[model samples]
Target chain A: MNIKHSLLNIFQDNPTCWQLILDQALYGYLISQKNSPENFYINPALQEHLKLLLTDFKSEEFSFEIKEPLEKSEAKSIKTEAYFFLNGKKIASKKAHFLSFSFQQEEFYIAVFSSEKITRANAYQKTYDVGLAEKLKISEKAFQNNFEYGATGMALVSLEGKWLKVNKRISLMLGYTKEELFKLTFQDITVPEDLEKDLSLLKRLLDGEIDHYQLEKRYYHKNGSIVYAILAVSIVKNNDGLNLYFISQLIDITEMKRAEKRIKKLFKKSKEQNERLENFAHIVSHNLRSHAGNFSMLLELYESQLDEEDEIITMLSSASSNLQETIEHLSEIVNMHNSIKNTMESIAVLPVAKKTIENLSSQIQQHNLKITLAVDASLKVKAVPAYLESIFLNFISNAIKYSSPSKASFLEVNAEVEDAFIRIDFKDNGLGIDLEKHGHKLFKMYKTFHEHEDARGIGLFLTKNQIQAMGGKIEVESAVDEGTTFSIYLKKTT
Target chain B: MSTLKLTCIIDDDPIYVFGIQKVMDVINFCESTLIFKNGRDALDNLSSIIENNENIPDVILLDLNMPIMDGWEFLDEFIKIPSPKKVYIYVISSSIDPKDVNRVKRYQDVKNYIIKPVGPEQLSTILKDFKEDNFS
Candidate 1:
């Protein structure tokens, strides 16, 4: 009916043309009786092609099956693209034409088999492969640039500890060239004392015990100097979980380490000098106070024995009292230095402030200052009891002593719990300090702001030392002739 | 309360000892007084007094810092002795150190800690407290 069926019948009827068709290069030919599907002949060229594509290709075991039914009178042909299997194992896919016809009297079948030809889809696949190769080349160039120009030293090491690749920074850090570094393993450049630790960590990484490791290690520079670096290392693995290479990055810290050593040496020297100074001050204060005490006692005894006040005795008595006062102040400072050894305890702030205010009640009443204590009853601070009491005494007394005579003065003592500290504010509307001129020297010894008769200038200095010894700090806010606010931050007790 | 029969002073400073003794006489602090230059002299004399079963002083004014033995060492040895009388010990020192003051409170025999230049007022308070303890 069709030209294709007519040509197929003509080819099937002529046995001479069958040989010509079997000799074709574009297709492989196979002939079989219609009833014997297992017995067939495979052309030599296709058998050679099968031997290349399959695990084992045997001509004797080759078989064919025509899934479409054949009519009884006219010739029927079927074309199919199917997979060929030998002994249940897939070999290859082939396009085949099966022509069922009567050659003489019995029915016979001729099959034409061909490998898949190169179509437009295959051509596109070929171009896609070329594009993938070009992209891979560009990415490899980018990787090379990163490895070569990175800031820190980088290296790729083999599993056997051999240096596989090294960047320029690694070469410079080790005082070796890139070519020279590759000839040696990382162990060769590492300091012997640090080798064992590095090797053990690397072993752990290789054993899958740790994903990565970082350590401060030492390496020997080419010039025999010790180089300090912070080394971070991780392993690269293949899809099959095989050890590929180690990626190591090293940051130089030799300068930092040298500076740290210098700082420590200086700190030790300063601490020793400070201890000696403290001891000297302690001895001086102790001896001076003892002599001053005896001098005052003798002066008092002399004055008591005399019926009338002697001018010389009175002058000596005043001098002795001044001497005693100076020595007392000196001893107080020396004692403040020793207060660090005192034990700290949590004491309620309100009770201590209340007691201090009560002790200075006469002075407060004399000054006619309204002293309002706004400290919470529940708030507590961590401090040495004596230091805390002295702190409160110095601030409250100073407030009373500096109260303004022109106006009704008010001193507000407020305590609030802040972050990790108890902030106590001693704010007084009194004769405020000229902080612009005296701010820098406000807390220095013997630096008095006002000409008040009782302003010794030692109170603030002593108070600051005591506060600091208890791990606290003091801040002052003042304005001339207006007011002064002293805020002390003490450790809050949970 | 009646006056104490006897009082003892143990100090290293002669000036301080002289001043205290004069003040005691002026205040009519006790009927009699015994003095030692340091804690060692007082400890030895007190140990002898205890051995003889004589009248131990009613009050002991102990100074902390001394040449041979300090007041702390004297108290350590005196408390070990089994005495016939209950003597009240008071630590009087020039040291205004809180540590020294707090250390004195640890001794049961120590009645109080007094800072020096004790003058008349502190001595009067001590005498009154002693009379109170005796008569109350």
Candidate 2:
């Protein structure tokens, strides 16, 4: 036998005197001499060293002190016994124990201890048990790998939330390198808004209030962008009811948040669309029935007055004209409803207003109605051009139609920017309405609230439909004999 | 129905009033047909007739949407009166809203809702349903 200095071949390749000396020293301090592997592996180099070392001393080396009895069945997830190592060495001597478990056949007992117990095991066995160490090491690595790449951002923290170890994926998610993150603590990167929540949960975990908890939390990245994540944290407990560290898994949901916002907007628009369609059906049914009823009435009149030759011609003509007007009104309502369903075009408010005024210039001059238009150049509205023109022309004509003959007609059209919208207020000082009572019925079809001979009450109703189709709104404010002001709100296009 | 002494036209429009009255005279719908401009005047006249113990009209032509008071309001007040007999009242309007027709159907006193302008044929058809055979 020869003496060896290298630790690589200490157990199998070469059994040196120094290695044997250290091994006997460790074994003697742990298990004295019950039934140990040391008794069987006593050979030339180690035996020479063991015998030489004991040549001067004279005492039994070790004995097994059992802290707890072993159970044959429950050898997993729990330890059955604690084997303490007592030594008189250069460092401070303390009782270091290992949690023990029996082997598969109960013929052997396999013990689990920390890497801190590496030096103490040399006496118990000359071989390092490389096969088992490699297997255990590989399994730990695999477990860490699976968690690292998952959607969850994982981390290992000391009991107090110090970042002991973190994966590359987690570092990427927080916008930091792994080396930089390992230096900082988990609490350091956590957003201030999420700090209180995390700490409170940690307190509960420390007090054994809960084993696990989940939260939708935010963390600050190295680049200062907020990282939104759904965090799931679990506590790793030590043997004596002490926390080892925390394991946190984070699922980032920033894209999900954006998608939720988009869906909510779509839902609101669809709900509004659903309501508008419901109203459209009712309006369509109402218009169709009125025309049908009027036609039937005209026919009834023509039939009954057929015997009266003197008044037959005139009555028939009147009945026919009324029927034709009813049909035309129905067609117009249906056509307007259909047009809005196709598409909405984008147009500038100022140009549209100018064009509308120019087209109705003759009528404006005919009524001698003074029109004051103050539209901002910055305002752009999305709407069908003709529909917009028609909406404006209808209001303008109505301003002239229902104007007070006694006073000078004054129609002021002015627009201003509102919140995400442009509001054009058409204020007239001619004739007003008793809106306190007839306000609700103003938009209803064929609802004649005024004595104006031309007031079929259809113009304002159609105007409302057109505006709504083009993503706009119109509201009226009126007084009986004072005046009327119609405010039209249109969404501003970028 | 019992023999009608007076038939009343309660509408705001004169043209519609004249047309219906002429149709009624041609069919001889009722004797001594009276006309009221609004429901207020009709209710006032009816209240006076009740005070005087005069007979209510055998057939009443009521317009639903009108100035001062409407057909629905007239029915509300007319039902409050302890009438000596059942009076057949018909609602006549140019409004073809189903809600209006359905609403008038709720009132038991309203015999029918006539779509306007009120023609002599519909009046004749309604008169055929009356118990009195004066027209025949």
Candidate 3:
């Protein structure tokens, strides 16, 4: 029989025989020279299968050491059971047939064998099972260690809220021993106000509406103190989809909750104290003004009765006026703080700026300062009309008062609408303040930078307060010798 | 030399009252003058004057921040009285609080609001305006 035909017939019988030969069995013919035992040829498919099976097997080279003796006696072909070894280790054993053929007067041995038992070796499979079992044991220990000793409060709770297992951190968080915790259900220590919410979240988790849930809740400790924690819970279901236990983690936040409450109380107290101070200031200013008014009235009556100009009378008049001005300023500040929310309206900025400029036109002319009003006609801001007027008057008058003596002085007022605010810039070519040295004290009351006689040091302070009370702000950029620009931001109206 | 008729000053401060009275005398502000210590005193006396059909003051200068019944309370009570004659009320206060000035605008009977330390010039202007208003 032709060997090629026989092999073809074998493959035809089983369509997947080649696949089985490559994966489950190694089938290849080997050529060997008896004199040179290392001269062996292995097919590429068998080399590929050996590469998978043997850890140290090299793919390009094959050295087959046959230990079983072959007898070349009866026929030109021989059939026998044989074993193949590499480096004294038997890799495969199979039934083999050898045919000796002479071509060109040179002797050669061609052996054909196939083995499927390499894959089904009991020792190899047993060793693999042992390695897998060892890996599983190590991973299970790691999980157990993390569950018992993790920093966060961890627990395994049954479907009925009974504690099946709990970590040390969980026991410490609830002020309960591990044994004590296992006896009590999670509901037993949960604060009554927080239980309903936690249970609802758990129900959603169990229904698979959510895979897990996080809640900020309160629990009662063994010492009867409240325990605040942020809890994260996940359900652990069986492979068959039945309800099992729950894996819950809690991080204690009791101190944070207490700190938040303390801060809230402190804020309330400070607000009340501030209100009281404002009220006291209002009363004092009112009473002082009344007395000062009486003094001025009495002085006026005395002056009218005198037939000649009296030095004392002039002194008293100036003193009383000064007192009146100071009292007025004080009352203005007190009233500004007290009447904050009321009297606010959308006021056209251009008209107010123009009116202020018109009111101080003579002062501008006296100072030889050129005033430019570039405020938009349609720009409006949400502010009290009186406060807006005062703010404009303060800025314009300040610019005029502090105008540079040497350079050509100009006060250019411009207004433009910005996002959520109307930014009015009062750019002036005046003697700018030394913002580096006096920036912190620029807006403080009674802190005048220049030696101008009219610098009462109250204008900028009142201006800042008014701006802030109207939910606005003022920013100033200045250099000592250059110029100052005051930018006012007010809430825009439409 | 006096302008027309009765004028009244209601203030708690004696110095203010005396100074205003002297000024009224110098300006010949009225033919007759009435002075009360506080808002309650003025309200009571004026109500009786209206009841008796006596000479009611042509103008009332009401001072706020008094001891008994402040000007606001007095205005509330006085405006409710059904009087035949019109009583012009002016709220004069030492308070620079705009709240008080804004509150006076609510009373239709209140003719004006004036800050305190009323000098001769302001007083003369007020009298001139009052005279013109009455004659016109």
Q: For this target, which candidate reaches the highest DockQ against the unseen true structure? A: 3
Tens digit per residue, CA lDDT, model 2, A149-210: 76567888887677777776788788888788878887898888888998898899878999
Interface RMSD of 1: 1.5
Candidate 3 versus the native: TM-score? Answer: 0.64
Cα-lDDT of candidate 3: 0.82
Return the lDDT, model 2, position A295: 51
Candidate 3 CAPRI assessment class: acceptable
Candidate 2: what lDDT? 0.69
lDDT of 2 at A285: 44
The pairs that clash in candidate 1 are none
Clash count list over all predictions? 0, 7, 0
Error of 3 at A153 (Å): 3.8
Compared with the true structure, what per-residue lDDT tens digits does model 3 show for residues A133-185? 76678778998999889889999999899999999999899999999998999
Q: Candidates sorted by TM-score, descending order?
A: 3, 1, 2
- Per-model TM-score versus the true fold: 0.61, 0.41, 0.64
- Stretches off by above 4 angstroms in model 3 are A1-166, A174-226, A229-251, A308-313, A337-393, B4-19, B22-45, B66-68
Lowest summed lDDT across 10 adjacent residues in model 2 chain A is found at A84-93
Interface RMSD for candidates 1 onward, in order: 1.5, 6.3, 1.4
Per-residue lDDT of candidate 3, residues B1-136 (tens digit): 7775888889888878888877777778878779998888989999999999999888899998898789998999999988888877888888878788789999999988988888787778777887788778
What tens-digit string does per-residue lDDT give for candidate 1 at A329-383?
7777777667665478899999999999899889889989898999889899999
